[model samples]
Target: MIMHDAPEQTVKYLSLLGQQFPNQQAVFTEIINLQAILNLPKGTEHFMSDVHGEYEAFLHILNNCSGVVREHVDEDFGDTLNEEEKDNLCTLIYYPHEKIALVHAAHQDSPTWYKRMLDQLITVARRLSSRYTRSKVRKAIPHDFAYIIDELLHTHPDENNYRVRYHERIIDSILETDSTEEFIYSLAELIKVLAVDHIHLVGDIFDRGGGAAKIMDRLLSCVHQRTDIQWGNHDILWMGAAAGDAACIVSVLRNNLRYNNYEILENDYGISLRGLVSFADRTYRGGERIDPLMKAIDVLLFKLEGQIIYRHPEFDMEDRLLLDKIDLEAGTVTIGDETHPLITSDFPTIDPEHPYELTPEEARIVQKLVDEFTGTDHLHSHIDFLYRHGSVYLVSNNNLLFHGCVPLNEDGTFASVNCEGTWRSGRDYLDFCDHIARRAWRDHDRDALDWMWYLWIGHRSPLSGRNVKTFERSFIEDKATWIEPMDPYFTLTHDPACCDMIMREFGVQPERGHIINGHTPVKTTSGEKPIRADGKLLVIDGGFCTAYHPKTGIAGYTLISSSRGMRLKAHEAFRTVTEAITHNADIRSETTQFAAAERRIMVADTDTGTKIREQIQDLRMLLDAYRTGLIKEH
Candidate 1:
């Protein structure tokens, strides 16, 4: 056993652990189990970022494990299955129920087809389950077919004729009972479960696309797979809105409206936008007034944001307060010596003397919206999931996952930002923000809710490095004023030293660790690569949102890290799910090997492996104590 800090510490811990183990046999059994687990292959981790509410695309990727299923099919079937047959099998694995229906409709020999498909599924399931322990696989198996799957997966036909007969008996029984469909579905799900051990949603699960709620539902249902989310700026905005922050609510509404995804608000979460919609229609009713209505909501969002800035002076976001600078008479807003023409000058709700103050009607609309945001049960449950399973950043298995920049200054040092009253930077700042975000949800503190709003768009907010140029982009004609300078972190990402500094700051090994970032979509068409700092950092937001597909020229990126190595999969834009189902069209993906290890990584090399080793050490000490008579065995 490796020597620890002190022998006395081990003695103390053994005394405590003795209560559970009680005997040498118990301690030895645990040690044996842990030792066996350490030799198992490390499970694959699927890292996705900037989903932006493209539920169909996101769900498809999750269902297919970013083409891992097809890869497995090729590996297992080889020349036996043709390309078209493989595609059909892959689709069945992804959408089992639908694919089964399609197969039934197409084939007249139902019994023969079911038997053949079942054979193929068991083959795939057996290969997928090879990396995991029998105990783990048994736990993943559906309760109804637990014994049957266990027998099939473990009992090899080559072992003996008896084993072959046993497997055939199980298959024959399944077919006789007409349980083929249920068994196939269970096996497909088990294959998916074994394909990826964990899912890392780097950020931006909401916005732009129409299916954030659907995506969340999928995540929630995957009980067997461990999932973690790093909160993105867009996610934080919605979180703040759910906490009843008016600024956040207004920002969410405006963003949804801009993307023509109002259904996400009204239909998905059941948040009533009737009051705001009515106000917009009634206030801006002249010809060509829809644009004017959007502008009014945009202005209201700015005012609401300004109110938060006013309340928190230490946020250093005074520059974002542009509402008071609008010269309604000139039909222009002067920004830094440039007076740009407004897209729409009508502002029936703003008070020029007190521009940030919402008029009675505007206030009523905002209050109603806030009530809907806070009162909705589904929104609360979704936000609760986010708070429970997410953070501003996460460091897992030597990789640093975050939604945005680490908030760096021009000098490439961590930029300090006010967290409540105290200033923090780097990991400290992120930890504080994460704590406050959870507190905002748990206690519903007004101060924490405001901070969440700050995190949504504040200049120093790591999640929102660029100033949200909502006002200027909406009202100003000059594109120059609309420029929101990116935080220096984005530019510094190419520097190995900068990447090392970030990794070290987050307490991960600079040489071995990687910073997985999202938010800034990688414009691959513009020659911008996702890999930075010679592969030490990866910016993986490859335009999951259709709004960004034109700019990014790709669907998105999924970084798959398994026992073998790490690879980045760049996918083309996904067509509708209907097309994928009807035509068996899969998202075309190109895989680029990012990093490959000299040897396959085992469980002993993983974070969980570290814990298992520690437990083994403790058990050893307990055994020593028992033999030495220092602790009596039961």
Candidate 2:
């Protein structure tokens, strides 16, 4: 084989490509296919942040695509279907098996109802499928009923009475075969897949709520749509614990206990907390008082954090080592000029000489907890998925998605952080931390594990932009001492110039790019806006966690970017999935139009489109080489 004169790299790339498509005809066909794909409308992307283990709300949003399914229903059958029919149809699409059971219980004529519902589902599916190519739609169809779905979707009964008979015959055969349940399930799933092209979970998939494990299971089992998770501080805490970090294990347990989520550890992940309970009961035995036990655990956590700081002085978190400053006899902790009374001086596990040292009992309990965390197959699988699909930050489709701030100095410049004696700032700093976090699990590196602990509470960590203030919140009574100032990035993010710098640093076009972030909840009740920097940055964490609902006054915010443009939706609280299925209740959402494109966006204008364009170029070059007689057609 011969080739035209080209650069060495180009020739090498083309030679590799030729191995797959060796003939001119194959190259031409691929080029044509790519061209056709480039002409299709861009797929919809759904963005939600700070789920915080609210699995019902999260699952409901995912199922209905932040109310996109309802919008599609309204658009497709605005006058044909009334509100009640639309609500029932949407519920069927959301919880197919459950809704079907309810329908069977309620309806006297089951067959007639099934046929009517099937017809409605087909109509909705057809409307959703219109945006995608037939090949893509076929791939999304369940394998068991692939042929049947393809036949139904392609054949139009309205074309003629004969076509109507054809459609009726397929439904009758399914009923006769007793396959209606399976068919309904497959169709509902297909409708969900067709509605949203991709899901972006911005951060905080763990903590507060009790259903993180359930949510993880749902995401892991997703086959049709794609999902990417931006690791939040809460998520990283659990990931570090799963890697067997002692401090992280304590932090996770402390948080779970504080939220009254012991069942999540015991029942969900099979993590036994009986040893900790026994230890706590024996050490702070006083009429089942949780406050004393909580104080003891909080002190233990501070000491563990101090040990990490002591090990790495470069972390500059010595101010957080408050155990040494506590006078156990006086029952007080001295900070700066102020000495505050301690709530409880019941830290029996803490040693005065070696304040950060874990006592024998505490050490045993920690070891058992670590074992429980890392030994559980379900927890391991969940963390493995996080490592597999999650990143500290993501740049996709001209947008930056991250869980927290980019650490910045008071003077509005990127803060230089020391990582193992090397100073890094901006994107380089985040990349360094991400590398260590993965290595903590993959290589079982001790330094990496310590760094994971550092990322949890370090002053310079982007995940934790402010001091944790756990000790201040627990021991100190003064409200002034409880203040944990946010990083300057939080204030500077409101400035368009600062946002432009961040966008440029991340290699995204500043004019069109946006930074989508979470971690801090948006207090809508207090009249706080999620959109910042005049639309250049967006903080979409409207508090999906029920604990934060009091402050936020809303369930959450979801950003939907489609062919038309981007829209931000504020959702009210979801009562329960049972209420949704039985009562046909959906989350009441208020949507605001953020941006609308002058022209509809196509595949050629997207990130995926860029990659397809490159492939087309290579194919064209290959075609030219074959025609020029420089390369053999075979």
Candidate 3:
């Protein structure tokens, strides 16, 4: 080969790449490894939305990978294992430590049982790991069992009789050493790890249910799994509170109190409510039998909300400024043209002339709560994690994932939003909102912090698809006034053209890309479908919050996007973890696959493949540099 002179910049880049490869042999070997990986089947991507703090259900669904583990179990053992055996095996996989104890308690922890389960688990793990490279599989294995797992997974018993004896001896040694339980636990966790290559939380990992903090803790603990979150409106509220937004702090307090989810604030997050408890006790007593804390928080919430509306008139939320609409004398509030009787008229904290102004005590309490919210390290950590892994929307593997709608006009056009002095719409608007959220958290900008509150409830906020009827529901007796009108996007999204427009605006190919959303509970009881826009969009929020189980008629939804295509699983309510561990009860899921064809998608067809190809190209360039004598090999 003739040596060629290279450009200075090109030499610089190739020389840097040479540090990792160092030699032509290393470069060529890596090229072969990456090329082989590209031909393997693509890893499974699990998508879940609107967890709403239901930690038990979310945990179970995550562990089971929305029934994908069960599918594998049934597929691998349908001919051999009975129904009872399969169910037990799945439960074991989900909660290994607990299931093992239960088995031990039942006197079923015999060596025979250990060998059988190890054999079965090893087989399933091998099948699951086949899609991944040996190095990737080794990395997923627990440190203590890395050698054992790698050996068991690679050794095919059917390939040779000697391999069977080798695998059996390892299991027997584990059984003899009384390490069966620990080894099984490790394998079970490894299986769970390999079941889903990536996790996409479409949004709402907070509020409604009491386990928001628990849910955040769980996600934070997932170090190995690739996970991303799309910010949900409810999530934005908590993020705002963590950034010390008074309106958001008051709103969070009110919602938690109203839903009786105070434990999450007091216990899980260590946010003190003692001040509010005292304030409520002294200021909110009346003929109404509602909890005084609830009443107090509601009054405080409205006062803060009114202030925000007045401060940001561009928010177009004057309709929510109902504090001044109250007629104390008649115990009624005028909404639009109608006057509705008030449910409670005790307004010791409100002044008719300055109704949005907080009373001296109210001001003190609100400030203290804001201080507490921003001061909590746990809250900040969770909020920081949210900011780190989350955005307003994400485009991954030709799918658009967002917690809510792309705000739209009634005529099926993207709605324009004014952020500061500039107007943005569609994807631009969402990007602006996402930028503000980060500024609120990272820089603690006052305006950005306030924008966080707006994102939670502003009429045109893409995160909040509907006008929140909090005030009406709190004060007005007439249910008509409490009907929060959803944005036109909610209705217009049913049109394929509208979804295509959204996909195009986000720079995704409309023909193959999907808009994945959450926020609105799909009311299956009312004959509603989660799939809309001729399958261009999927709303996976099937009510993970137990409060919505009645309306949604299901536990929740988890979408599995694999090489085989997208499949939606509507899950039945997961019974308590205790029941699941004790009685082997699982959340039964109904799977619906919507694929145009059953083409086995390989790594070469995915975003990961695109990245690997780039790496290969760079390596090949380095190889060229070496052969051409432009760069010397190590």
Tell me which residue pairs clash in candidate 3: none
How well is each residue in 242-266 modelled by candidate 1, as lDDT tens digits? Answer: 9888889888888888888878887
* Pairs with backbone N, CA or C atoms under 3 Å apart (clashes), candidate 1: none
Error of 2 at 614 (Å): 0.9
Q: Write the per-residue lDDT of candidate 2 for residues 1-634, one digit (tens) a residue.
A: 2356677887777778888899988998888889999999999999988998899999999998999999998998889989999999999999998998887788743888888888889888988888888999999999999999888888775746787788889989988898988999999999999999998998889999988999999999887888899988898899999998989988988888889988779999999877777777778745423465576578678878888888889989888889999898997988878789876677676778989888888888888888888899999999999999999999999999998889988788999998899999999999998899999989767789888888877778888788778888877767888899888999989999999999999999998899999989999999999999999999999999998999999999999999999999999999999999999999989998977888999999999999999998888888877788766677
Q: How would you encode candidate 3's per-residue C-alpha lDDT over 1-634 as one tens digit per residue? A: 3236667887888889899899999999999999999999988999999998889999999999999999999989987999889989999999999998898899998888988899899989999999899999988999999998899999874755898789878888998998888899889999999999999999999888899898899989888789999999999999999998998988888877777898999998888889889988898875685667778888888888887778888888888888899998898888889888887877777899998888888889888888899999998899999989999999898899999889888888888888998999988999999999988888887789879998998888889988889987777767877788899988888889989998999988998889999999999999999999899989999999999999999999889988788899999998899999988899999999896445899999888999999999888888888988889999
TM-score winner: 3
Ranking by lDDT: 3, 2, 1
Give the Cα RMSD of candidate 3: 1.8
Off by over 4 Å in 2: 1-12, 157-164, 285-292, 628-634
1 versus 2: better TM-score goes to? 2
Highest lDDT: give the candidate number: 3
TM-score per candidate: 0.96, 0.96, 0.97
Model 3 CA deviation exceeding 4 Å by range? 1-10, 157-160
Rate residue 461 of model 2 by lDDT.
Answer: 84
Backbone Cα, N, C clashes tallied per candidate: 0, 0, 0
